[model samples]
Target: MPPQVVEAMQRPMVPHRGPEFSEFYIALIERLKRLHRTEAEVLLWPGSGSAGWEIAAVNLLEPGDVVVAGVTGDFGDRFALVASTFGADVRRVELEWGNAIVPERLDAALRAAPGAKAVLLTHNETSTAVTNPLAELTAVAQEHGALVLVDAVSSAGGIPIEFDAWDVDYLFSGSQKAWMCPPGVAIVVAGRRAWERTRETGTHRFFWDMDRNLEMTKKGWTPTTPPISLLYALDAATAMIEEEGLEAVFDRHRRLGDMTRAGLGQLGLRLLADDAYASNTVTAFFPPDGVEARTIIDRMASEFGITLAGGQAHLASSLIRIGHMGWVDDEDIESCLTALNDVLESV
Candidate 1:
């Protein structure tokens, strides 16, 4: 976390029901709305990004409802699972793990699964380091008259998302990724259609109820006690984002991604995602011919004190992911690349 975020979190607490807290909550929601580039209703929940998936499923879907999920990686599959758990018949458009989902494929899937209530998508699949074409995919879903729910957990703040322009029905993200804050808060943005579904759907929910959250939010309060410290951290982080300008922040992430990908390529390392669909926040790549992913990760940590993530599920042993999201810069990417280069040479 950044120093400002840390300092903000360290400040003393305030009464959750008081006017001061209400004002703070209202302002934070506005900032979050600005970040999302939407005037839609934004809800704050005390949970991780995974909770956002459940929130979307429980509130918008009923038993036996057909939901089409574009499964590109682990997160996308998890989202489909969440919807299935909530009794939605989730028909997944499974793609290769390292590739982004194309619009034509989604359009075909929707055609096959007629009367699908919603389409679940991951804006950026961190597992594969691929950013899906959200706008085009959303357009296709809309054409099929389906509500579009997006998991923007890894891309929201780092990547440019025009929520209103795309007519996205619902989108959610967590505080830890590009928000530059500690984990705990799940940020949800819902449009008119999603709110309407919440009222008509009979999926049982209490804590993740969108209706109750909306009622309380109008009064500048949350239905339950929130993670105040994380909110403080986010408040500071959003201010920092505002000061830096969203366009500039996005440009920096793009530059960092390009630098990391170019450096890895120069070292003869292969990126998992194609250049056209590569994520600006995280980059996934394969290890050298004989080097193990774990060996590279361990050596990078033990030698240079730089921690990297291994891939999920089936790709666990073959892929390594390097995060270049919030609180990162050109120098940081350069350092990580330099250390990775050394680790490969020594191995």
Candidate 2:
């Protein structure tokens, strides 16, 4: 951990209702608003990114109520499953595993489900390494009067998400991704439309409660005990992002993607996604001829001290994904590429 972050966590514990804790909580929320670029309410939940998933479902979805979503990859499919657990009639407009949800299909699905309450989509499908055009697809959702909930866990901060400009109803992200911090803190940013819908929601939730989160935050604190250490870490991460400037951070990730793509292209490796739809944080590549991806990733980690990630499901044997979101630079990219080349030669 960084020195400043260690110091923040080492500070004396304050009562949940104490003046110090209250002040810090309020200040932290304000900082998040600036970082998220939203005038909407930002709720910090004390669990992983999936906790925000449940919160969104409970707060907006109801049993038997029809919900429509674009299933571009595993994240979107899992998000629909969670919402369906709330008893919502989840309808999916699925694309092939390697492709994104086309805007035309998204619009058609909304029109098909006339009374749909919300439409779920992953802003960036980490499984397939692709970024969706939220701006265009949200326009289709807004036209149908359905609230848009985006899974931006791997996309937010690593890329640009225009919350206010796009009129996104609800957006969720976590600190583990581009925020460059440890996990355990998930954020939910909701616009007034989604908050208003909460009055009619009957999904029944407590710890991951959003309505009470809004109410208790009146005093600048959570309704229950919070994760004090992770909270401190999140604040420090936000400060680090601010110091780097958001555009510069985005550019760094973009350059990483560009360089990785170039390197993989030079290596004659097959990319899983098209250039236009590729994710800035993760890039998936099919191993070169006569080479197994798992072997390359394993050897890179064990022999060269270079840890890399393999693809999911069908692409596991063939593809390896390079995650270069936070705490990564050109040198790290070079190291991964060099080690991958060496591993392929050895294999």
Taking the tens digit of each residue's C-alpha lDDT, what string does model 2 give over 230-261? 88878887887778898898999999999998
Off by over 4 Å in 1: none
- Scanning candidate 2 in windows of ten residues, the lowest lDDT window is 1-10
Per-residue accuracy of model 1 over 300-337 as CA lDDT, tens digit each: 99999999999998999999999999999999998999
Taken over the whole model, the C-alpha lDDT of each candidate is 0.94, 0.85
Using all chains and alpha carbons, the TM-scores for the candidates as numbered come to 0.99, 0.96
Highest lDDT among the candidates is held by which one? Answer: 1
lDDT of 1 at 187: 93
| lDDT (C-alpha) at residue 199 in model 1 | 79
Model 2 Cα RMSD, Å? 1.6
Regions more than 4 Å wrong, model 2: 1-12
